[model samples]
Target chain A: MKRNSLHRLLSTCAAMLWASFATAEVTLNIGYLAVEQPRAAVLSNLDPIPDDDGLAGARTALQDNLVTGRFLGHGYEMTEAVVPEGDDPLATAKALLAATRFLVVDAPAEVLVQIADLPEAQGAMIFNTSSGDVALRDNACRANLFHTSPSDAMRTDALAQVLVQKRWTDLVMIAGTRPQDQAYASALRHSLTKFGLRLSAEKEWAFDADMRRSAAQEIPLFTQELGDYDALIVADELHDFGRYVLYNTWQARPVVGSEGLSAVGWSPVIEQWGAAQLQSRFEEMHGREMTSQDYAAWAALRTLGEAVTRTNASDPQTLRSYILSDEFELAGFKGRPLTFRDWNGQMRQPIAIAHPRALVAQAPLEGFLHQNNELDSLGLDRPESKCEAFE
Target chain B: MIRVATACLMFAQPVLADEIWVTNEKDNTVSVISTETLEVVQTYETGERPRGITFSRDFSRAYICASDSNAVQVMDPATGKILHDLPSGADPEQFVLHPDDRHLYIANEDDAITTVVDTETRKVVAQIDVGIEPEGMAVSPDGRIAITTSETTNMAHWIDTETQQLFANTLVDSRPRHAEFVKDGAELWVSSEIGGTITVFDTETQAEKAKFGFEVQGVHPDRVQPVGFEFAEGDTHAFVALGPSNHVAVVNADTYEVEDYILVGRRVWHMAFNRDRTQLFTTNGVSGDVTVIDVAARKAVKSIKVGRFPWGAAFRPTE
Candidate 1:
C-alpha cells in the first residue's frame, strides 16, 4: 500500500515538472507606432500604398522572428498602435513605452523627436522604420533611437555612385512640390557634389496629377524641353508624376531616383544573397510583395532577435548593451554582417540599387573607400556626425 | 616557396582517384579531368542544368541532378555516359547517397519534399514534406538521421531514417543552402548563403554550438558567403568555399577558428578532395574554371579552364 502511494506521488511530480517547463517559455513584446497619412488621390496611380503600409512589414518580420525564436524557446508578440490622422502620436507612444521595451516607429520627424524627448522612453529602444531625414541621423539623434530605415543621404548617395560608375554624370534634376520631395532634392544635391557630378538642368514638376485628364495633351509639351543630360533624376516622394515621366521623356536617357533604377532599403526584385527566401516567406504570410517599409521593420526585429539569441538573454538592458557592443553582428542576408554604428544608432547596411525587375548593383561601390567601413560612405560618417549621444 | 614545396609533395604521393568530374551547370555537360595528367580527359553531354553530381559507392555510376530536366541521371563514371535516369521529384537541386549504398535522398526544391529513392529499383520509397525550397541534403555517418536545408525556411530539418519522420528543425540563418554532418554525426554544420556564416549545431542536444564567419580584406563582407564544406582526415580541419569572395577558408574544425583564406577563382561554389585528401578541386562559376589546391599547404596551386558556370565536382576512383 505504501509503494502504491509512492508511485502516485511520482506521477504527480512528473506532471508538475512538465507543466512548469511549458510555462517557462519567454515572451518578447514588440511595440509599434505609425501615423496614418493618406496619399493624395492622384490620377497617375503607379505604386499605391497598402492600407496596412508599414505595419504589414512589421507583421511579416514578427512572423519570421517567431519562426526562429520557436527553436530557441522564445515567443514574440507585437502590440501595434496606429495613430489616426492628426492624433497625438507622442501620447500613444508614451502609453506603449510603458509596456514594451522594444518599439518600431514610422512617425514623422517632429513626432519622432517629441517621442525621443520623453523621459519614459529613456529605457526603451525605438527603431525608426520610416523617416529618411538626414537631420535625424545627425544633429537630432537620440540615444534610444535606432534607424533601420536608410537615411536620405544613403538613398541619394547610392543613386549617385551608380550614375558615376555608369559615366552618367550629367543629370537633369526635377523636383516635386511636396516637402518630402524638397528634402530628397536637397540630399541629391549634396550627393551630386560629393560624387563630382553636374546638374545639367533643373526643372519643377508643376503638373498636378488631377489635371492629367483635362491636360492630357500637354504631357508631351511639358517633357520636350531641351536638356543635354545622361539621366533624368526625379524627386517625386508623393508618387506624383515620376512613373508617367518614364516613356514621355524628351531624351532617350535612363530614369533614376524614386522610380526607375532607384535606390531602396529592400526591393522585391532582389533575389541575390538569399533574398528570394525572405521574399517568398513574406509573400506566403502576407500574400504580397515585401516593400521597403516591411523590410525595415523586419530588419529592426531581426536585430533584436539576433541579440537575444547571441546573448541568450531576454532582459532589455542586457540586450541593449550586447547590441551596442562590437561583438554584436546581425546578418540580414544583405551579403554582409550588419552592425550598428556606434556614433549614431543607425544600422549600417548596403543600399540596394534596383529597378522594378532586377537588382542593378549595391552602393559603396568599388574604390569608394572608408577607413573603417565602406557602408559609412553612404551616410553621415563618424567625423561628420554631430550625434552627442554616442560621444 | 612553401606552397611550391607542398605542391611537389602532393604530386609525389600516388593519386588514388584517376579522374575528376565537374558539372558544367549552364552548358549541360560534364568535364572529366584526369588526376595523373591533370587535364580534361573527356566531355559528355548531360541533361539541362546538371548540378550536384556524385558517384555510387563502387564508383561505377555517377548520379547527377539534372535540375531543369526534373530527373536524376545515372551515368557511367568511366565514360561519362548517361545510362539511365531516376525518378526525382520536381527541381532536384542536391542529393546524397546513403552509406548503405541503396537509398538516395534527393531534395526536391520546388516541391519542398525530400524524396528517398531506392537506387536499384529506381523508385521513390518515401516523400518527406519539409520547409520551402529544400536545397541541401546530408545523411549522418551512422545512417540514422537525414538532414535537409530548406532555403526559404532557413532551417535544417532532421528526419529519422528509420521512421522517415521529422524530429526536429533547427533554424540556422538566412537562406541556408547546405547541411553537412561532420565528426561522425557529432556536429552538424549548415551554411547560410546570405547570412555569410557557417552555423554549427550539436547533433545530440540539437543546439547551436558555434558560428564561424570569414573576413577577406578588399572583398565585400556580403560576398563572403559560405556554401559547400569539405572535411579533411580526422575531421580536424575543414575548407569552406566562400561564394564570389574568390577565396576558400581553412577552418580548424576542433577550435572552430578560420586559420587561412586561400584565394581562388571568381564565384567558387563546390569542391572535391582526392581519395587520399592530398588535393582539392574547386569549381569557379564566374571565371569558368576549376582551381586546384594543395590541401596540406593550403594554397591554390593551379587553375584550369572548364565549361561555363561549373557547379559541382566529384572524384572518380581508378578503373
Candidate 2:
C-alpha cells in the first residue's frame, strides 16, 4: 500500500543500516506484574476468601518451577524488571516489552491475551506464568505466546488419573459456582467419566452476598469423611473452603479436592532424583520455598534456556526450533527426563499430590507404569489435545 | 473499682512485635512463639499450608510459606494478623534467612521459583527461575551465595546472591531435597530423598566432594531420604533427617562416614539445634512428635508430641 514511501525509506535505511541498527546485547527483559504482592492472600482470592498462608510452600517454587533443565552454552540472559506495587501492570508490561522482545507474566488470562495483542507485541514472545485456562491453548492460541501453567484440562486429567489409580471410582462432587470453576468441575467430571469413574453426588456452593455465611456452611457440608465414598472430589478452584475440604468431609477418608490434595505440575517435597539440588539453589536465592508456578516457569525458562544455550543465539525462531527438535534433553525438576509436547508447547511432566506438610504421592503412582513412563500418564495425552501447533 | 480494673487490664497487655513470631503449618496457624520464651507461648491464625517459616534477620516481620495459597502470608509478630501477602511461587515450603536478614529467601513449591523479598520494602524484588520442585534453601555463611535444592531434578543450584542470576546448576542424585552450606563456607552438604544419600560438594567447583549413607536395615533404600542436616566446617560430625525411617543419621563429614543412627519418630521431616549445639530437635511428621536428641550422647533425650504434624522448630535464645 505504501511501496513508494517504503522504497525511499528502505533505500535510506539500507544506506544507513550499519549506522542505526547496530548489533546489541539483545537483552530479554522479563516483567512480572501483579496487583499487590504476588504472595499476599495469594491463592486467597482463588475464592472470595484466602486460603492459609503458603509462604513456605511457595518459597521452594521461586523460579516458578523446579523442572530440571540445563543450558549447554550461554548467549541469552533473562533480566527482570518489576512494576511498583499499585502500578497498572498492563501499561508497565507494554512499555517494558516495547524495549525488550521477551516477557513472562504471572497475571490472569485476560491480561495475558490483552498484552499479546499489544502494538509492541509485534516481534515478542510472552510466557504466561499464571492463568491455567485451557482456552489459551485452543481458541485463543497465538504463535507468539506460550503457557507454563497447566491448562484446567491438564490438572483435571491428572486428578482423574490419581482417582483411577486409587480406584476411588465414585466421586462426590462439591463444586464452587463460578464460570471457570464450573468449567473445571465439569471437566473433572468428564475426565472421571472418560477415565471410567462416576460422580455419586454433585453439590454446588453459590456465592453469598455476604462472604462470611458461605464460609460458615461450606466445610461442614463437606464433612462427609473417607468412608462415605472412596474419596471426596471438591472442585472449588477458588480456594474458598476447598483447602478446608481435605479431611473436613463427612466420611473421613482421604480427600482429593481443591485446596488440599489437588494435583499439579510440581511439588516441593519431591527430593527424589536431582530435584533437591534445584530446590536448594532456589531457596538460597529467594530465601523461601518453591511453588507450582515456580516449577512450570522454570521448565519453560530452562527449556528455552537450554535451546538458546545450545543455539547460542537470541533468534527466537531458531531457539524454538532447537526446543522442538528431538535431540533436546530436559532433566531438571521432575527427576525422570522429559520433553515438550509437540502439539502444544506444554512440558510433559508428572502431577504431584501435596498437602502443606509434605507431598502425599505422585500420580501414575509407582506400579501403574505405562509404555512411555507413568509420570506422563497424568496430563493430557498426545492423542487428546487438538492443537495443531505441535503437529 | 471495676473501671479502674478494666483500665489496668488494658494497659497490662503486651505490645505485639512486628513479625510473625511463630507458626505451626499443619495446625493451620502460627504460634507467635516469643523468641524470649524458649517455650510454646502464643499462637496466631494464618493462611493455608503454612509450612516453611522464618523471621527477617532484623526480626521486623515473619514469613510463612503457604503452598496452598501460592503466597507467603507475611505477618506482624506482635498482633499475628497478616500484615501483607507476598506473591511467592506456589507451594512455598522452607526458607533461609539472609545473613543480613534484610531479605528473606522463599522456596515456592508449585511455581518452582525462588522469590527474594526485601524485608524493608516487604515486596518481592526478585523472582528467579530455578529447578523443578524447589524445597529447602540455605544462604552461604559468607552471605555471598544462595543455594536451593530442587527435589524433582535432584540438583542444587548456586545463585550469585548479589545478582540473583543462577550461575551454576550442579547435578546430584535422585530426589535431591535439602542443603546446608557448612558453617565455614568451604563445602555444601545436600540431602536427597529418593536418592537416599547426602552429597558434599565443593562450593566453588560445585563438584561432588563426598557422600554419606546409611549402613543398616529398616532404612528403605529409597526412603533413606536425607532432608535437614547441620554441620560444622572443621568438625567432622553432622546430623541428617532420614525420611519415613524416623531417625537422624549422625555422620562424619571428613571421612564421609555414618557414625551413628538415632531413631526419632515416623516420617521425620526437619531438625534444628540449640545455641550451644548440645541439643537437637527433629520434627517427626507422621508420629506427631518432636524428638529432642542430645548431641553428645547421640541418643533421643525426649519425645514431645507437640501437635498434629509438627514440622519446624527453632531456638532464638541469645547467649
Candidate 3:
C-alpha cells in the first residue's frame, strides 16, 4: 500500500513539471497593417491583380515562423488590420500600434511617414513592404521605419547594370503622367547618368484610348518620332500601357522597364538558391503567383521572427537594435543573406532582372565592384544618404 | 603446363585503380578521375543539372541527384551506363545512403520533404515532411537517426529512422548547405553557406555544443561560406570546403579552430578523400576543375580540369 501511494505521488509531480514547462513557452504577437487602394486597370487580362497580395505573404510567413517556433517552444500570432479605400488609415494605424509594437505595413509613402511619426509609434518598429519611393530611404527616412521593397533608384540601377553589361547604352524612354511613373523616370535618368548611358529621347504618354484595340496602330506611330535607339524604356508603373509597348515599337528594339525585361524584387521565374520552395509554398497556399509586394511583406515578418528567435525578446527597441546590427542575417532565398543597411534601414538584396516567363539575370552583376559591399552599387550608398536619423 | 597456367592467371588479375566521380551542374556530365593517374579517365552523360553523386556499399552501383530532371538516377559503374531512376520527389539536391545499405534519404528542395526510398524494393518507404528548402541530408553511423538541413529554414530536423517521425529539431546558421555526424555519432555538425559558420550539436541532447566561423586572409568574410566537410581517418582533423572563397580550411576537430587554409581553384563546393585518405580532391564550380591536395603536406599538388560547374564528389574503390 505504501509503494502504491509513492507511485501516485511521483505521477503528480511529473504532471506539475510538464505544466510548468508549458507555461514557459513564449508567445509573440505581430501586427500587419495595409491601406487598401483601388486596383488599377490593366490592358491585358492575362495578368490580373490579386486581391490578397500583401496579406497572403504575411500569412505564409506566419506559418513559416510557427514551424521554427514550435521547435523552440514559442508561439507566433499575427493581427491584421486592413483599412478600406477612403477610410482613415491613421486611426487604424494608431490602434494597431497601441496593441503591437511590431508592424508590417503595406501603404503609400505619405501614409507610411505619418504612421512612423505618430507619438504612440515612437517605440515601434515599422516595416514598409509596398512603397518604392526613394525619399523614404533618403531625405524623409524615419529612424523606426524599415523598407524591404526596392526603391525606384535601386530598380533603375539594376536595369542600368544589365544595360551596361549588354552594351545597350543608347536608349529612349516613354513615361506616363502618374506620380509613380514620373518618379521612376527621374530615377532612371539618374541611374543612366551614373552608369554612363545616354538617353537618346524621352516622351510622355497622353493617349486616352483603350490600348487593347489600338496598341498596334497607336504605339508605333507614337514611338516613330523618337528615331532609332538601342532599346526602349517605359516608366508605366500602373501597367497601363507598358504591355502594349512591347513588340509595337517603331525601331524594332527591345522594350524594358515596367514591361518585357524589367527589374523586380521577386518573380515567379526565380527558382535558384532555394527560391523554388518558397514559390511553391506560396502558390499552394494562395493558388496564384507570388508578387514583389508579397515577397517584401514576407521578408518583413521573417525579419521580425529572426530577430525574436535570436534575442528571445518581444519589445521593439531590442528587435530594432538587433535587426540593424551586423550580426543579423536573414536567409531571403536570393542566393545571399539579406541584411539591413545602417544608413537607410533598407534591406540589401539582389534585384531580379526578368520578364514574365523567365529570369534573365540578377543585379550587382560581374565586374561591378564596390569598396564595401557589392549590393551598395544598386541603391543609395552610405555617403549619398541624406537622413541623419541613424547618426 | 603448371608454369603456363600461373602466367595466364597473373595476366588475368590486372591491378584496377580507384576512381573519383564528380558531377558537373552546368555540363550535365560526370567526370571520372583515376586515383593512380590523378587525371580524368572518362566522362559520362547524366540528366540535366547533376549536383550530388554517391556510391553504393559494394561500389558496383552509383546514384546521382539529377536536380533539374527531378530524379535520382542509378548508374552501373563498371559500364558507365545509367541503370534506372528512383522515385525522388521534385528537385532532389542531396541524398545519403543509410548504413543498412537499402534506404536512401533524399532532400527534395522544391517539395520541402525528405523522401526515403528502399533501393531493393524500388519503392518509397516514407516521405517525411521537413522545413523549407531542404538541401542537406545525413544519416547516423548506426542508421538510427537521419538529419535534413533546410537552407531557408535554418534548422536541422532530426528523424527517427524506425518510426520515420521527427523526434527533434535544432536551429543552425543561415543557409545551411550540409550536415555531418562525427565522433561516433555523438556530435552533429551543420555548415551554413551565407552565415559563414558551422554549428555543432550534441546528438543525444539535441543542443548546440559549439559554433565556429571561418576566415581566410585577403578573402572577404561574406565569401567564406562553409559547405561540405570531410574528417581525417581518425577524426582528429577535418577539411572543410569554403564555397566562393577559393580555399579549403583545415579545422582541428577537437578544438574547432581553423588551423590552415589551402588555396584551391575558384568556387570550391565539395571534396572527396582517396581510399587510403592520403589525397583530397576538391570540386571547384566556377573554374570547372578539381584541385588535388596532399593530405599530410596540406598543399594543393595539382589542378585537374573537369566539366563546367563541378559540384559534388564521391570516391569509388576497386579491389
What tens-digit string does per-residue lDDT give for candidate 1 at B154-192? 789899999998889887776688888999899999998
RMSD of each: 9.3, 14.4, 9.0
User: What is the TM-score of each candidate's chain B when compared with the real chain B?
Assistant: 0.94, 0.85, 0.95
- CA-lDDT, candidates in order: 0.82, 0.64, 0.88
For model 3, the chain A TM-score is 0.92
Candidate 3, superposed: residue stretches over 4 Å from native = A1-24, A210-213, B1-15, B24-31, B37-51, B66-75, B80-91, B110-112, B115-129, B142-145, B159-168, B202-209, B216-219, B259-266, B286-291, B294-310
- TM-score of candidate 3 on Cα atoms, chains taken together: 0.86
Every prediction's TM-score for the first chain? 0.90, 0.75, 0.92
**lDDT by residue for model 2 (A1-391), tens:** 3222111111001112122222333322333333234433222454232221122222233233213423222223333444444456666666666556666666667777787788887557677766777767766766567776777776787777777777888677778776657878877876787678888777776555555544535566545332367777777765665765565566666667576677776666776444655666666766655667766666666555555434456666776666656655465545344556656666656667777667777665655545654544555566666566445
Candidate 2 docking quality: incorrect, acceptable, medium or high = incorrect
Chain B fold agreement for model 3, TM-score: 0.95
What ranking emerges by lDDT with the best candidate at the front?
Answer: 3, 1, 2
Instruction: Please tell me how candidate 1 rates in CAPRI terms.
Output: acceptable
Task: Give the chain B TM-score achieved by candidate 1.
Answer: 0.94
Give the winner by lDDT.
3
Q: Candidate 3 - CAPRI tier?
A: acceptable
- TM for every model, in the order presented, reads 0.81, 0.49, 0.86
Give residue B208's lDDT in candidate 1 (0 to 100).
Answer: 95
Can you list the residue pairs that collide in candidate 3?
Answer: none
For candidate 1 chain A, the 10 contiguous residues with the lowest summed lDDT are A6-15
Candidate 1 backbone collisions, by pair: A57-A294, A335-B222, A336-B222
